[model samples]
Target: MKFSRRASANWKGTGADGSGSISTQTGALDKAPYSTKARFEDGKGTNPEELVGAAHAGCFTMKLSFVIAEMGFTPGNIDTKAKVTFEDGKITNIHLDLSATVDGMSEEDFQKAAKDAKENCPISVLLNTDITMDAKLV
Candidate 1:
């Protein structure tokens, strides 16, 4: 099966001084503000890298949950944070920091599951950059 999602952006004026708003098909973001300042400096609103990080973290966590279940372990709680490193006008790296609690699962098994998730998550596959992960069974 295949699925599609949509988001739109509208920008006006020049690159450095222009401002934009992003909107999603679900209305989760209805013309939300974004700008160069928000991306490069301390400013209000959100940026593409931040959005990518959120998506990556969410996808990896969900994938890990399924992987744990497939490995005969019950997943309790999983938390992941993705840090997307954007440098020199390119996305350089993405690092996932994960902490998970699984029932009757050893640290080695948890690490294996997390590694699988990090490598196979949809967003991870889509990104063309270095992906590193730190997974801890807690």
Candidate 2:
């Protein structure tokens, strides 16, 4: 199975003094905040890379929760953070940290389920970024 999203951005001015507008094919045009000098500096919002990080974190958390449920435990909460680090002008890695609280599960079981989720989740497969996952049951 395959899915794709298309987005385009138009930039005006120079770095540290320029701005841009990024819009997706879905009809969402986001302006980068002009007050700050950034890579996507143009309007008053976030960049696509930031949005991708958000989606990765949310998706991984939900996938982890589902894996835990399959082991007969309900997840109380999942706190996930994903960082996309760029190195040498290219995305080098996507690091993920997930803390999960579940009812009626041992740390060992949670670890196993987390490993499964990291490997089996759709986003992990779709993204070309290297993944580093830190899953702890608390």
Candidate 3:
């Protein structure tokens, strides 16, 4: 199976002085603003790193739920946070912090499932940077 998603960005002026708006096909981020200040310094609006973090966190959490179900455990309240580190004009690393509640699952089993999901999630596979994770079964 295959799927495609689309997003668009519009920018004006030079890289340092320019500003842009990003829109997604799903309308979730219709003309959302982005700028150099937002990306490299404290400013309003969103940036690529923030969006990547959100996507990674959401993808990993969902994948973990599925992995738990596949392992014959019921998953609950899975929460994940992804930190994308950008350095020297490149994405250096991504760190995923996960906490989840599952019924009748051991710490070792949950760790294994989280590791599998972190390694196999679409975003994890798509990123061409180091990915690390810390998982806790709560």
Ten residues in a row with the worst lDDT in model 2?
32-41
* lDDT (Cα, tens digit) per residue for candidate 3, span 84-132: 9999999999999898999899999999999999999999999999999
- Report model 2's TM-score to 2 decimal places: 0.74
* Residues 21-53, model 2: lDDT tens digits: 766676755443332344444455665567678
State TM-scores per candidate: 0.97, 0.74, 0.97
Q: Compute the lDDT of residue 58 as modeled in candidate 3.
A: 95
Give Cα-based local distance difference scores for all models. Answer: 0.94, 0.77, 0.94
TM-score of 1: 0.97
Pairs with steric clashes in candidate 3: none
RMSD of each: 0.8, 3.7, 0.8
Higher-ranked by TM-score: 1 or 2: 1
Writing each residue's lDDT as its tens digit, candidate 1 over 20-103 gives: 999999999999999999999999999999999999999999989999999999988998999999999999999999998997
Off by over 4 Å in 1: none
